[model samples]
Target: MTAVSIEKKVNGTPVASPELGEGRDHPDEEQHTPQPTPAAPSRREEKRLDKSTDRADARLDKAQEREEARRDADHKRETKEKERQAKADRKAQQRADKDKARAKRRKERRTAWTSLQTRLTHHMPMWGLPVVLVSLAVGATGQAGAASAAGMGWASAGVPVLTEGMTLTLAGLTGQAIEQRRPYAWLMRATWITAAGAATINALGHYIEGKAGDPQEALYRAAMYGVASMLGLVLWWVVMRSKRAAISGKTADEVARWKRLGRRHPLLMRRARRVADNTGKSMADAYATVWERANGARPGEPSIREIRASRRAAYRRRLAQSWDGRRGLRKQSERAAAVVPVPQADTVGTPESAGSAGVRTPVQAPALPVALLVPGGQGGWVEHPVPVLPMATPKRVRTGSDQSATARFPQGKDAVSKRVRKSVHDDRLNTVRALVESEAARGCDLRKHPSNRAVARAAGCRPGTARELLATVLAERGITR
Candidate 1:
């Protein structure tokens, strides 16, 4: 509320005093006034201020760290998600591949089954004696009400099993006979005889017991027993397999010697027998001639040493020829040519007429043309036009390695086709696998005792080849030897 007048010289000039005109202070006067100096803070106050400043900086640093941590966690989560997706993709791919393979295999099996059924029908006769006996046996078992129930526990179950088993066995026998070009007719006949004998035995028992019911019931019991007797034939077959009859009625020692020789050089023994039959000479003499030819011994007769040398040479030759594909082809060609027979010249007259010295005129029929010998379209000899055979086209045979590739991929252009083919892979070495597997399925252990020898015999291959194939199969199956 009080006013004081003050004067100051500014730049060597006198300053002016202003009167209060309004409720505002003079801007020039305020700019010229000197303000009071601010006091410095005490040590405690400064410390408190410094602490507050430090806390603010720490809070900002914590916020930045939290942001960085959050980013790192996000990055880890994203990386893990990507890895999981990759793993799942791989598993899905593997599953898809397995499914495709199974589908392809099923298709191939279906086709093979169809082909097998067709082959089976031709090889077996449904109306044969074997079938009749089997039917009769089944009918008897079904009709033998009290007989089956009073027997052992197995009897009731065995009736159906035996029926099915006998049927399967017959089918197998038919296949074996046809595929192996062997005769099983005698075995089938033996089965029938056993069945008949069993029926007779059963009938006699019923008659003796005075339990003979209706004729039909008696026959049923007999038929059931007959089927059971048929099993005896199977046992007999097994026994016969182990016991070999004397070869051509030779003595035991001679047969033993032949077997020993056959084991080493089957070809040599076969040639000796063939030569003996053709020349009407003794086997010993035929063998000696073969030895002489093989050894290049004397022009007249060879010594003991030369004969031994010839035997060794013949063995080596046989082994070498066994591996020679060219030699096998040549032999096949020769056999084919021999099968096409050529007609012999017609005899001018009978031997009796020529020997009698008769001057009678020989009545000769009109000569037939040589072309008449050729087969016609109807598979019969034609006297008019000669039938001409079409030229055979050569087929490409895949070798071992090529066969593996072809079996896997087949010949295809589409990707799906190629994939399907690759899914069901195979190997050329599996050519004998079916034969080996069949024997194994029949409870044969070709890997023990006889080892490769048994497998080779069953598969129709050399022992060495069988061993190699067995190794490959075991390797594929992940089995250790």
Candidate 2:
């Protein structure tokens, strides 16, 4: 044991000392040291850890669900897009098909039109050559026969050649003139004259032969000879006419129309030609001008559409005007009530008393009961005292003093027949007027001098009636003719 001094200080000043002992004699003393222990987790921390785990799991599940929903949406979107694309493809294919069909149809129509035009315009060589050959042979034979009968013998054959050659040359000249669009009237006349002379010669020869034999046989032979001699000329003339029409740029329809117009309106054609000569205009233009001047309308005026529209308007107006009356009549007939008139005896004045005293005594007859016919439950009409509605008055009324009720109402089948006749007359008059207007619009020179025959033929009316209607229409339109 050892002692040691211990001191205590307050502030910096030493105050007291104590003895301390050191023990070194114990050899087996144990040394002990303190160590810290870890503290356990709290319930809130464990709860928070569990909540974080749950939140992580929930977030993962939500992410998986979102991905699945997105995938589904994408799949649905792709399907919809594919369907739309397929629909578009189908539409495109259908459109292509329709276009192909339309194109094919158009091609077919064009092909048919081309074929038709070719058939119409290319017939000269097919029939013309055969006809020409036959006609030439016949003409030559006829001419030779005529010459032989005239006692020329072999010289007659040479004469036939000369005549046929001259005719052919003239015919060729006429064709050339037609092709050149030149005036071939003189050439045509020459050809006709030559052909006629040849025909006459052939007929004369036949006549001479027949005079030596049977007269009937001579007539038949002469006729045959004349017909054979003119066959070639006729064929050539037709070809040349067709060629002329082609050169004039006139279609068959136009030629036919012009021919029809000429036949129907010779006066118009003459007037048009005169106008053409005076105005120095083309015949067509001059014709139009003349037609306009005469008809008071341009060519093709009052078109079918216009006429139809006018007719429809007239019909509509008439219909509107008659609708109410017709409807009322129909309704009244459907619910008709029969009316029985009550007869009352009339008061009579004695003639002698009136002459003697200038006064008349009136006598009244017995009144009769009025009955109305009504439908019974058994579908039969029964008379009753029930009041019935009176018949409706006519739409038109006459206020003249001379017109009686009977006259105003116009009863009986005769009245109906008269009405029907008047209606028919009006319809016929309208028809005539339409025909006249249509003719005028179609370029007929109706104002100056209308063709009554043409009008009568078109209207199916008497010529006198047509003339009267024409005059009436012309007068109504302030025209002189």
Per-model CA lDDT versus the true structure: 0.53, 0.69
Count of backbone collisions in candidate 1: 0
In order of appearance, the predictions have TM-scores of: 0.25, 0.34
Error of 1 at 201 (Å): 4.1
Worst 10 residues of 2 by lDDT: 18-27
> lDDT per residue, candidate 1, 280-319, as tens digits?
6577766654544343332254433454468578766554
Show where candidate 1 strays beyond 4 Å. Answer: 1-67, 83-178, 183-189, 199-481
**Model 2: CA > 4 A from native:** 1-127, 152-158, 260-283, 300-481
TM-score result, candidate 1: 0.25
- Give per-candidate clash totals: 0, 0
Q: Write model 2 residue lDDT over 149-203, tens digit each, in one string.
A: 7889779879778888999888777777877767788999999999898888888
- Report the lDDT of model 1 for residue 442: 81
Global Cα RMSD, each model:
28.1, 33.3
Tell me the deviation in Å of residue 469 in model 1. Answer: 47
